[model samples]
Target: MKRLLCLAVAAASIPVSAEDRTLEHVLVSVPIHRQESNSVLPVTVITSEELQRSVATTIGETLENRAGLANSSFGPGVGRPVIRGQQGPRAITLQNNTSSADVSSFSPDHAVTVEPLLAKSIEVLRGPSTLLYGGGAIGGIVNVIDNRIPRERIEGIEGAAEYRYDYAPDLNSGVGVLEAGFGNLAFHLSGTSRSTSDLRIPGRAIDEAALAEQEEMMGHDEEHEGEDHEGEEHGEEEINNSKGKIANTDTDTDVITAGFSFHFDEKGSYAGFAVNNLNNKYGIPPGAHEHGHEEEHGEHEGEEHEGEDHEEEEHEGEEHEGEDHEGEEEEEEIVRIDMDQTRYDAMVHLYEPMDSIEVVRGFLTYTDYEHKELEGSEVGTRFKRDTWETRLEVVHNALLGTEGVVGLQAKSDTFEAVGEEGFIPKTDSTELGLFLIEDFHRNEWTYEAGLRGEYVERDPSTNAASNEDFTNWSASLSALWQFDDNWQTGVSLARSARAPSTEELFSNVDAMDPEELVTHAATGIIEVGDPDLDNETSLNADLALQWHSANSWAELSVFYNQFNDYIFLRNSGEEVDETAVYDYLQEDAKFYGVEFESSFHLTDLGPGALALDLRGDAIRGDFKDNGDVPRLPPVRVGARLSWTGDAFGTWVSVLNAGDQDRPGDFETDTDGYTRLDLGADYRFSFAQERELLVFIKWKNITDEEIRLSTSFLRNYAPEAGQSVAAGIRFSF
Candidate 1:
């Protein structure tokens, strides 16, 4: 702890120049846009400039290295945010304050449909946003802001385009975007495409079974089909994967968005509408296929038969008998995730500074999402989700000596699944909520509080499933005291409640054998659900410190959370249908974590400015059984030396993670490794009011073999190895 304080003190020594001032980040997830320094919640904002500097494949990976954040990486196409050691339904992803409305939270293998390539800004709000968002946000919220909803009218026309590529995975990507306006009307259009081959790793950390599972699903027996497993050592055959390639981990994606807006004569008033369509198809790093995995588990309930789909579709009369032709034949039957989503959003802003209110805002969105798990060209587990949401807020600049916002939010969604591997049952979920938030200040001191009440219902298609009508309430209070011009400290307390998700209440997959366990297609763990589960209520506390100026800044945040009736999966210590049996259960749990971030301007070396950046985060969680939480990220610390000039920028950083020894039940320890990254960028203006920026970055420069504690596939697939990425982008 003393060492952490010393680091903060050192970071506080940076000097600030008035010429290149850093804009303090701000938060807009709330009804009103406010500076981070004024918000009670711990917020991390990543500007568009920062996004352009990093080579990120998924939205979750883009912010995974940030303080108090982790990524649940499933191959290269899937990355869900894990904040403060909480994930899944506990945390939520949003697109401009609306839920992403994807099935990413349903399982780790499912990818999020939102594209980060065209994002204008991103925000991570730590702690509960139960009032503003919903019970789905017991952990936090990640909001990606895009230009789909035009906010201003251009004089003529303007646009930007970017093309990017990487060597390690042979990735190619590009994006085109434009905006035009006539009088009070404006329009926006954008398109993005990305494709990549199999991912590359440093070593063969992958297991042999993972590589051979695809062929096994294709109805080929190694001993009889001539692909003999001759030198099996202790049941672990190293499949020559040392070639440094993680097969079936490739991806292809395309996205298009259009929007229009009409501005009124009154300032701060506008109405806009947008539509976005996303299509993505990505491989699921071989191995998790089971029984040809049909989409409907109930089709053959209580049956011991698995993988009968190959009964007639054996190679489709393709080539056979030859060794080379057979090898290509088996590799062709890899599994992939095919997904698409379309969303429409309409929003309005009105400015009428009356005696009681300052402004009124409304936003509505509709989303249709679907994804199919393909096992050798046949749909395995098909999932679909449709959602509609709307919110209205009234903001008051001063109400009884306090600034306040009152809002009402409603949402409804239907989720359905079919196919052999379908785990969760069909269900309809709806919510209605009301919230009131206020902020008060007095001479360098600030106090904020919020209250929320919500009603949620979960109805399943099966009459045997549980139906719930839950009423939940949440409250939070915070006090910030600025002791000096450059130093400030604050504490926040919150009590939030989250209702059970659909999967936790109605998942009842028909295992291959009623007496044995069956592995889940997504998690590779057999799972069951309980219809009697209850809502989880949490008491959270946070303490934070900040000291900042124009060129230097330091921050430290610590948090603790305790929950009652926490819904979690528990191993039954038994086998069903030849797979491990895990059932949903309720228990008491506790989670705690600390995060530190600091930046110091070292010295102005020649014509450029030099700075030192240091950051670290760690967390631990346990249930009443004293068992560690599953897939928790390990402790990490890193530092970077950066330089900035008139038209050039460069940075070098080293990130290190500690070994994770506190493994969950039935889990093994994960070794740690260090990674180095170097990046540089240059900007050139070829025309008036137009500039092109080019950048190159080398990630994992040492080519270290690494596994993340937060990944479900840590044992079967390691993180990407050393890769060189370069890109060019232009704007006018």
Candidate 2:
């Protein structure tokens, strides 16, 4: 790791020309209600500029680097953001305050349908927001804000177009965006396409040792070559040195979106609609060689064994042939395992104020989503979901102002899995919640407090007996103190909970191969309809300090969280026939973390100014006897130093992650490593009304082989190494 840091420093010293400086920062702004009177939750906001500068391909990837957040990748095409180590249905994803209807909650193989390129801003809300959103948000919420509809009537026509390209490891990608506005109406449209072949490690070939171990598990011998036929001759070189393309390793994705909105004359009144479509295809890596042998033996054993007397002889021959056939089949299957996914979403939102009361406001949202996946010869699975939400709130202006809000929400989902034995089911749920908040501000001291109550009822389509109902509540309090003009401190405490989703309670399907096993349950250990499967509750606390001086700023925060009856996946200790069963269980757990960030101007030697920024996140967690959770991101630290001026800007950074020792009952230990990246941009002002910007970036500077602990492909191969990309943007 020290050597890796040294390499990164050396790479950062690369020369940059004076004419190459440019502003590459992304600028974002969104309308938000004042938090003074209604909400005490600590919400973090990330601008588009911050996301654009990071070497991230997806929205989840961009958020994973944030403090107290973890991201797990199923492969190159799928990633889910984990808040304080909680993921899946526990964390909610919202596009413009509406739920994203993608099948990402059901499986890791599916990709999120929302596009990051079109987002104006992304907000992560922490604390007790579950009352308004539902049981799925015990952890937190990720909100993607986009402006596809006009909030007011436009007097003239206006439009903007943007294009970007990136190159990394063995992958290359491009994106295009277009937006226009006319007469009280605005429309947004965008298209993005990307493709990547097999990735390559920086300084190493495919981890042959790891591959050999995987082959052994599959029951294959290392001495065998590619030959499977009896009496077939094999070359010594082929048997001794195995080198070839890795299996199930490719990715391709495309997306398109179109949306429009209009506004009325009344203040705080607007309505808009949007439509999004996405398509993605990726490969699923193959299992070990031994599994292949058993399958081959089973397939040809009946045909090869003709008579009873020869059955014994045929069995012996079958063993040898099966092993060879398995080896060959493993290679073939890895390259052939392909899956495709398609999704569509439509959403509408309206916000207005009552005429009788200037402090009273109302908001409503409705969304419809459909998604489907295709794997091999199977028709895959399909899901359709609909959601509607309404909220009414009144603001206060007096001392220690009082605010109250009441909300109602409903969600319905239908699922279908087509195959030999068709499986079809559906779930519908409705929730009602009420909240009140009070804020007091005097001199340098501020205090906030809020509470919420929610009632929920879930109904199942296929199994009427599975219907369930419950009520839950959450509350929070926070205080901030201003020590001086440049210094401030804050502390917050909250209690929250998460209710089980339909997929966790009543969906049973075969979703894995030999090496990987997945089992859904019709009823969890907590029991459905037991009236006792209430929300899983948690307590959270945070302390933070911020300091700002002329040309510099810094922040540090520490947080702790404890959960009672935490919903987690664990080994059931019992196998059905020959397959392992992992049941969703509730247990106690704890998590703690500290984060620090700072940015400062280093020098003024250029056209503008040179700056340096440092940031890092460290997290640790304990699970009560259930073992550590699978795919927990390891502690990571990174820093970037850049020189920014009028026409040119350059930056270099290094990232390091500690090895992960926490493995679930079915997981393996993952090694840690470091990576380096550098980027620069240049701008040219041709005409007063026209400007051109060019960006060039180099990732994995030293091409170090680093594998993320939270990656599913870590066992087979690490992430891509060094690569370069250059693109040009024009505005007029």
What TM-score goes with each of the models?
0.88, 0.78
RMSD of candidates 1 onward, in order: 6.5, 8.8
After superposing candidate 2 on the true structure, give the runs of residues whose Cα lies further than 4 Å from its correct spot. 1-42, 126-128, 151-157, 169-174, 202-246, 266-268, 287-373, 383-400, 403-408, 416-418, 421-424, 463-465, 509-533, 664-666, 686-689
lDDT of each: 0.75, 0.53
lDDT per residue (tens digit) for residues 1-732 in model 2 = 232232211111222122211222121111223431122344556655444444355667767666556665554555677776666777778776666766566554455666676666677765445645666777778887766554455444443345555554255566555566665566766666777664444543234454444334323343233535333422111211111223345677777767666655545345566555566666543322111111000011111111111111112221221122145423333322223333333433334344323344344555455544333444344556666665555544443253333344555444443333223346676767676656577678777676777776766665334677767888778788887988888898888766655555554423223232322111111111122354688898988887766677666776788888776544343433333344455678777666665666677874777776666666556677654555666766676778877788788777776677664433445677677878888878775456677887887788676666665455444565677867666654
Q: Considering summed lDDT, which 10 consecutive residues are worst modelled in model 1?
A: 296-305
Q: After superposition, how far is residue 190 of candidate 2 from its true place, in Å?
A: 2.9
Best TM-score among the predictions, by candidate number: 1
What lDDT score goes with residue 13 in model 1?
10
Could you give candidate 1's per-residue lDDT for residues 518-590 as a string of tens digits?
Answer: 3455544566777778888999999999888777887899899999988876655454543445577788888
TM-score of candidate 2 versus the correct structure, residues matched by position: 0.78
Evaluate residue 607 in candidate 1 and report its C-alpha lDDT on the 0 to 100 scale. Answer: 90
